[model samples]
Target: MGQKINPLGFRLGTTQSHHSFWFAKPKDFPAELQEDERIRDSIKNYVQKNLMKVSSDFEGIIRIEIHKYKELNTTQVKIDFGRQNLLTREEEEEKDDKEEKKKLELLKTKAKIIIQLIPEPYEEPHILAEYIALQLKNRIPLGKAMQKVIELMEETDIKGIRIQIAGCIGGKERAHVQWIREGRLPLQTIRAKIKYCSYKVQTPHGVLGIKIWMFVDFVDEEFVDFVDEEFVDEEFVDEE
Candidate 1:
């Protein structure tokens, strides 16, 4: 904020006083005359007479009202001016860079995945367990949900198995895996559709959608147990 002050102002009644006058006087004047009141009076009268003549000769004389005005020294005003110029430039660049970085980070953390499962009749529990293991394998590494599914089918002598694999979409950090085996007809079907269909997940900060499709052989109880015992524990601990 800038202060508003009156310009051309007088202080201590100094305006119109003789103390404000400047004149060129001869240096050769007698030393004694310099201190003489009569000499001083003569010099004042001479300067005043010429000043009056010059004022009268002018076509128009404008009188301005005087008020006290705050004066900023050259050095102080220069420092302030430089700071204003620098801040204007810096603010614009900083704003642009911040927006660009935010966009790049958003691109990096986007979430996506695909899963496929083949459920066997008379083996619902084993199939569900195998699907869970497969989901965990996809989430982790070096484990095969599809391989376990295949093994289970081979052991049970089931043929022509086809399980619908669903897509789950959410923030990588907050995504949850859920299993459902039974429910009201419509609700169960809806859940299966959602799990299979491409889904758009919303978070407080942003949104991401994913498409998924997968195929596997059979469920392996041992592999599922391993995932439950080892991989899940590691994931939770690592997150903590």
Candidate 2:
């Protein structure tokens, strides 16, 4: 009657929803299904290339969403980037960000594509998974990576946090699972507002998989919404 399942999928109507919104004809469904993969890969590669050009640390992509409208002949791609900063002075960092925006505008015109870049909030599941992926890529021990990220998340207002990493952890020959947790993660409670994401990273030794489940308390949810609105408002208010 019961089996292992994704928390988001299990509670779809209550708390989780699809990031992409589009429909395809049955004949075109197979090709359209693979389109998301292509979009994600292209954006990932483009972001990495841009980072290398700027010599900046990977800021991590939290999610990429696609929406197509056949009647309008339009496709919309939105990307949410994690909260990672460049190693520089405040003024230079702001300048770099402005320059990146300018470049994106140029890209939109040249590529005939509409892409919206969004900044992900602190300690989201995909953002955490990306942080751990970078640490793993750098050959950091799994425990240290989990502990470091968890310690940071502890300062936030999350109700609970859990992380799992599997496959050749610590560069061992055999694959194993390692996990770390802080506070309560009520999988049985559909109202708990849990966000989950699974990510895979390729290391020199082997491939490692990471899963993060974040329980966010709804008490602060209003403040969270306000922050997003404020951020969006700033762009228009401050833009010349």
Strongest candidate by lDDT: 2
C-alpha lDDT score of every prediction, in listed order: 0.27, 0.66
> How far is 177's C-alpha from truth in model 1 (Å)?
16
Which candidate achieves the best TM-score against the true structure?
2
Off by over 4 Å in 2: 52-59, 84-121, 218-240
Instruction: Find the 10 residues in a row with the least total lDDT in model 2.
Output: 222-231
In order, what is each prediction's RMSD in angstroms?
Answer: 41.8, 6.3
Model 1: worst 10 consecutive residues (lDDT sum) = 73-82
Q: Write the per-residue lDDT of candidate 2 for residues 120-192, one digit (tens) a residue.
A: 4556787678778888888787778889888878878787999998998877889999898999999887766
Residues 83-155, model 1: lDDT tens digits: 1122234543452344234323432321111111222322332323334333543453212444454455456
After superposing candidate 1 on the true structure, give the runs of residues whose Cα lies further than 4 Å from its correct spot: 1-122, 129-138, 141-143, 168-240
For model 2 the local lDDT of residue 190 reads 72
